[model samples]
Target: MHDPSLIKVGSCYYGFSTGFEGGPGNGSITIRKTCDTTITTGWTYVGTIWNSVPAWITTRLGSTPPNIWAPDINYFNGQYYLYYGASIWGTNTATMGLATATNIEGPWTDQGEVTNVNYPIDPNVVWGPNNIPYITWGSWTGNGINMHVLDAATGKLSTTDNNLWHIGNGLENSTITSNNGYYYLLGSRGNCCSGVNSTYYTVVGRSTSITGPYLDENGVDLNSGGGTTILTGAGPEVAGGGADIFDDGSVKRLAYHYYDANNAGSETLNVRTLFFGNSARTGAADWINVSAPIYTPITGGTVTVSSSIENFGWLKSTVNDGQESSVSGAMGWSSSNSLTTNHTEWVQLDMGTNKSFSQVKLFPRTDGANKGYGFPIDFTIQLSTDGTNWTTVTTKTATPLPSGAQVYNFSATTARYVKINGTNLRTNPNDQNAYRMQFAEIETSGMNSGNLAVLKPVTASSSYEGSDWFTHRVNDGQKNAVYGSKGWSSNSSLTTNHTESIAIDTGAVQSISKVDLYPRNDSATQLGYGFPIDFTIKVSSDNVNWTTVVTRSAYALPGNSVQSFSFTSQSARYVKITGTNLRSNPNDNNAYRMQLAEIEIY
Candidate 1:
């Protein structure tokens, strides 16, 4: 069995799986139904939806008993649509067909081939924000991961040509879901069907629009080969793929199959909680896997370095002295001062005060085209408070670095000065003759400090017309001063005086230090429209017990800018911002509302 797709209707859940048996009805799509909402047990085989390969499919693909694979079932407009792929394995001559049923256990009607683009497989459908139904399907040889708007009634392509969205080299099984104004594309990469040797894992990318140039957290476009790994087989699980995401009211869960390492790598159903967190580099949210119900923020605050306390400021073997300024890329570090050498080198940073740190991040030189060129192949980290006495913390050997920052987590240790010594420095991976020891930045994370509210579920008292403007937008990581399309706005034309508030649930209690609010500035005529005049920020552990962190009454906010309010760190799981007195739009007398581009909590 392969490529299982899941759907829930009423009290029962239905799953469609891929199979190929060699007869008239043998290769048809298989189905299983269960009443267990938890989806851990009680699955009853209900048999295949199609009795045999449809005549139309066989004629189009020039094959009989076409191997039907990767079936997806979705209910829309009071009808169940089953989309399946019909093709020969490892070939580009394939077609995706649709079947409709009035019930889950159906006497179905075949809708014939939707498209015959490059061995189209893995048919998945999702409704966009505009309520238009879009279908995504493709395989390795064809236009990888093609998408097209569908004629809702006919389940056929709305356009003449299939639109190629992402080129997943040998990767397929594409699925999509939307949350917090972003559409995430999840796909399986690597060999699948090889049992214990299967290299299949799940990769994900996201875009603000349904049809998009989806990008990973590193800002690499999916079309240009970029996706963040979300789940891979580990320990007892050898491989994981064929993923499907479902929102079960309270929280979202990912349902997929993993090859069990202990059980001869048999594919078995596994489920896990999924989350999205803020990405500082892209100013957008990215998916994260969580073990517990509570989420851990991926990005966090780093320890402040007061100054460098190095034994040798420059590389002794180099002709020009390598400056200590290269050790820190904080404001004034010049590119010319980047420490460079081919021999052993060491740099230490004084953090000004003794602090407990759990993680250290090293950023290699990314200037010009020398990305990940001078990173160390062997390195060790040490900690010292008095600068004279040092304790070796961790050592890494012969690790080839990628073109991005690498992070290492360690047992919590206290130190005012941190030192890193490098030997066996890497020459350029592309150019073996080029050899130098250089780095852009070294950062450390202090204990109990990070963005607390990233990707948490948010709710608001009200929305302006309840259209695109929503409360969740405030925390969606889109902070554009001129593009009002991505922020939250309170109701328009408010005749009665009332307060509007938006609240976020952090999933677990966390210490928060500050909140930054960006007021709306999307319109030229209404540059400061909907800026809150008087507001109060509050935190709460239990929703019933609230503690006011900051309160401003009759205060005017600056337009097109971020206003930050800080207070002593407080612990809470929920944070709320309430506008008691909203500023009236200068252009509209009746419109007294509050709009915010983003809300950052740390």
Candidate 2:
């Protein structure tokens, strides 16, 4: 089997493959279905789409036997078009044909040949930015990969052919996808079908326009023999090729086949996460292959830490800005800053609101040739919601340290402010007896104090109260019960197995500093009532791509006070609070419910 084309219709995913009848060697097109949206499990064979080659294909092949090589499936205007290749092994007489079906499980209507060119093995149709349908196909022996506009209503080429791209090494099985603002061309390189000896791998090139001049990350033009490698055989997987990409709601996923060495180099379907990020070297957006399937939702664009350091107030001892030995850089308290001092000094980052965190990282000064200069020899990390009372997070005593950043990880804790107290100083290596304490940067990771949900529009998976206890009540800014009730409550009474959620949309993407949740405190009996025992705070920019900012299991809320959670800043337009295991309200003995008085977002 080779060249699997995947498409999603309704609630199920369908895959079409080129294969033979007996033990997968017949020249027929087979289809399979899976209810799993990710297509990772529970695949059910849906039988063959075509077993015998059509008379037109047989006439075109002439002396060669009728056999399908590559089959690609795409959906357009409520019709599924299965484009397939008809040719013999290692021949240039290949022709592409189309078959249409209204439903995935189909009685396909043969649409005959669509392309007039020879060796049009891999036929993939993609909708361009202008919503125009374009089909691309070619083989190594042909004129590289060729593209032409398609009339989707008639299932035929509507424009003159254009040479889209090519690589010096023989490559074929082309598939194109438009993402962000660029069109990506994925193709197979090297030889295939040799089992463990197969050198087949995947390479990609991109262009702003779908017609011509595709380039790789290094600015090497695909038309001039340039491509960036994406996937290759490794370890048990002998060869990876025949790649295709599709949007799986949140992120793009690549579906291909790999020869498994351990399984006698049998070709098996493989799917993995595909990430697109800016290439630091090329300054262009490039595709990334993550080895495993990622369940996390990705916001459409890059999210860096907000540059507004002043938003989170700062405090420090010996705050001098002019001298290079000032605490200004250290007190700036951003990931990028270098602070130096010849005396013991302390710096604190005030988050402005209560938040939770679990880790702190300290970077020693390394701005110039001086590495590890003025590094702290001993220090104490403390957390506090109120400045007066502090809880010692960790203490270091005469610890030998290395240059660069060092991270201290601990159990999740809550704080409104974090302080790094320099109890002892290390002598500057270049200048002995010159006691100093300096750091390049300091960062706190995990949840911290800030309400990121304040004033945002609220939504829920299911609402218990249509009017009074609606989802919007959580963000209504009323902490105390105004008229006997304080917030939103779920309708699932005593239903401990149900999962409920409330979400907020901040309109545009904003840097999320922290989230604060206030439990229902209106009535004396409702104190500490209906708080989620297991909960997750998720953030998303497009509502569909959600990333879990924090997940707490078997958590208990004390009283009706506000609970703060902090995370390394994430940019999100939507924030959701999901609860699975809810606490039983004392007033309602039969039902486990979720209730929140207020939610704040910062």
Candidate 3:
């Protein structure tokens, strides 16, 4: 949305922005709501305020423009008034329109034109000194900024003492807020709508009188094209403008849209705390700082260790449960390698679905008894979409001191699985110097899309048909479970390889991008023992005429992990995994069968 406006109602916040090409306001005003208590993320679109372009606007312009201009919303005199424009870009022949409703969620009725004089465009309402509310608007096209007394009763221009008074200039959008004893005029200067090449930035000027001359920090009049630069951004986010302030009964929040070069120059909404401490709050200082963005805590997922010493409170889940410090007792993941013989160990985190991440951190056991006793002697950090095809992100040839957390940073990538493979283990001095792999916590993060198939309809050619290894377990989003909830397994009767197949229906035809298969993780000795050795992945629109997208032979075991298979996009309603050569579990007395703990479809 261009020139977005923000407002808070109770615990809720709403954003109204200009429509896109095929959206409601090239047809009407688009509305969206906040996701959580947090300012923004996964915003819920609340439909357009109106269906078609207002008849008065189309009649004034003679034809509908491909898109609409900036808009503002306010609550005044026990009603909500929405101000919009009937104008095209780079033209002086424009008018600002008004719509008012009893409530925010409204059947807003158009109250005709608010200003058709002197190239009026971006319109906003700012209440000033006495009990008067003033409407302000301006663009670089004509006089910078203009304010007129707004009659709260009719939500229009006042009949007495109202004039098109000039204030500040530069570009569209005049967001005025009265702080202490001064009125501040905020505007965006320079060209916009050019994406990365756009040079637009925000500027500010202040004035003691509500309608008189506004001056920048350098004492230059805004009417003379002078304003102090406040927010000059850089790429990834190149241009920032169309700013508004929202007070939530506490601090004031500044909201705007910045063009992101990394995402094909798409404009994205941004909000930050406008910190004006005591001095800045009193106008003694002119500069204000916008706090850095805050990130949400980890969207945790089920964790699986190749072989953990769960007998001692060293469950795999402890590794990511925020208990790395000395506050807790002996906790975190520790391998079951009690013998002196060295063996490679691994731990993996299944984020439930595909995610985009960059950094992975591992915290060593902080207990005084074993500060860094089992820190990996040599290790590699690997990532995968499906647990099968692994890409080594970084390698530690030599072990580092177990003084604190080990940090690994790399270029951002999207995946579903993260694995820390300890190739060589450090010897525990307290346990007869036995080689081991230990860590208090491991944190790897990123955002998520989600799985399309979790508990969807599934069928299998042969299932264990027991309470434990039922066929539905493959799509239950579980990686760690006891034998009772352990995953799908072929029946004893069909013990031969290539005798097992499972199919999932996604409820509707979707563009299939990837599929993941997870190995059973409950049994330490049987982990990764029954994974399918050879398999074929097939997609079908009708579940009859199937197309094979991938075929694998000599696929390595997951070591009790997931294997992700990403291929060319395929339109399908059903996905099938057919095992050609099943794994024989030596731990299960050479049981020839197929088994998988979970499946993820993306």
Candidate 4:
């Protein structure tokens, strides 16, 4: 299945996908359904839109194309619309066609050949400023993504304004969605159909207006081949692309396909919850994975780096996310700061339970200026069951200055904790000439991956009801921005007294060593920890008797730093932080409040 789109009916989810194989569905659209609430599983094929290529398309092109690819599904006023593309391979252009039905399981009326353009392959329907239906199609050409204002009544090209609006370039399967005050154009780059060697990945660019120049996280224009990548190949999945955006009310999701390395390199479907990272002035923040994160999941997992530059959505967990940009990726774990680590910085992943893995792969940021810019000068990978004890699995003492994924293969080892300790750091002239340790992603193979704290019970002393500040988000695996993310924060009323607390019951407490705390990465509250001045971290075995692990006062402002509180190992089911003297809210003119982007206890 390639280029899949979804819509939920009363109680069922219907998936419309591009099908080019098998008997009845070749060269037309395929239909599938999953009754399960989780949209990823239990999908059974229904049928195709037609037994063969629609007669209108074959006659219009005067020949049969190989297949109908990239079918985008949409439900329009009093009807359902299916927009797709058909092309003979190697031609610069393909014909984009539309079909409509009252019910999704269609005897779809072929609305033939909508946009007249140089090359139109993937047609996606996005409503514009006035809720006006606009056809965003074309790609597989140098012309980039072009837009056609659709006639609202017919759901086809508008007669009045058929002028093509050239949007961003260097992407395909072009999809656009809006949030806050910005519009994002997400598309696919690289090849997709190849089996194991497929290099397909997703990239994104955003604009303030619906149509115009779009830029990536680092403000690179998309027309010049610039867009931030949100997901890529890792673990059992490879060659991820054919992207679409699904807005499920409170959250936006990225639905794409990847070649399954564990499943004979088959093209498979995957949907992960998309998250907004640190807010930029253009409202174009990098995307972070909240649920169904990109890499091999470690059950009850948490990642803490030795030190990091916490701005621009670069967090420790970003390494584990596995979403690296196709071009010069910017948002990754970078330790280019004044933190005192004795010139050694480390990134550690705590698998909730002991797991087995044979290989670890670390990727350096594609900073474009320097090939091995953020690649560690020298590093050693270690594993440990008890967090305190460690055994070196592999070490690269040599510089190994390469710009791609550095795979370190070792014998299968079992451990709850794994880390890459960078002994010597690379010089990052981009970052004030600081000694830097950076990685775009960290991946482990042959290990059981799952989120243990997802949907776990959470309790907070005070929480803002709306504005994306629900308390349960601390351990939900999604890292969102302070403004856009549903991170936990106190209501504005609690500005003076600092009695706020947040605790996560990690089901059962195992060997706990450290806690990772992320302050909201909103551009407004750029540095300060929203108002967590003085706090005591305590653990409880039965939720009644508590043991205070560490108590600190006069904690200085983190200034976009991920605060890691390491303490003596505690055996407890619950971990809580109670603030005594909460920090002052910078935006509120130094009024005190308690806020946190996320909390991970391990």
TM-score of 1: 0.50
CA shift of 112, model 2, Å: 1.0
lDDT of 1 by residue, 256-320 (tens): 77677765777776655566655423435445543321211123223222122222322222211
Q: Superposing all C-alpha atoms, what RMSD in Å does each candidate have to the true structure?
A: 15.9, 20.2, 23.4, 16.2
TM for every model, in the order presented, reads 0.50, 0.50, 0.51, 0.56
- List candidate 2 stretches off by more than 4 Å: 21-26, 64-66, 159-169, 280-291, 294-602
Evaluate all candidate structures by whole-model CA lDDT and list the values in order: 0.69, 0.67, 0.76, 0.72
How much is the lDDT of residue 481 in candidate 3?
48
Could you give candidate 3's per-residue lDDT for residues 1-602 as a string of tens digits?
A: 67888788777777888776667645577888863444655467887777777777878877776666677889877878888766776566788889888877787888989888767777888887788889888788877788899887898889896677888866567788766577777888887889999988887788888896988877788888877766675676677888887775555667778898766899987766554321222223533444433222244667888898875767777888877653354478888875658889999988866665666888888777778778898899998888999989879977865799876666555677899999988887777888878888888744333565666667898887685887766766676546556878877533555568999987567568789888887767877866788899999989899999989989887775578898877889899999888888777767778888888887
Best by TM-score: 4
lDDT ranking, best first? 3, 4, 1, 2
Candidate 1 C-alpha RMSD relative to the actual structure: 15.9
Point to the candidate with the largest lDDT: 3
Cα lDDT of model 2 overall? 0.67
Q: So what's the TM-score on candidate 2? A: 0.50
Error of 2 at 353 (Å): 30
Candidate 3 shows a clash count of 10
Scanning candidate 1 in windows of ten residues, the lowest lDDT window is: 316-325
Off by over 4 Å in 4: 279-598
Model 4 lDDT at residue 109: 83
TM-score-superior candidate, 1 or 4: 4
Question: Judged by lDDT against the true structure, how good is candidate 4?
Answer: 0.72
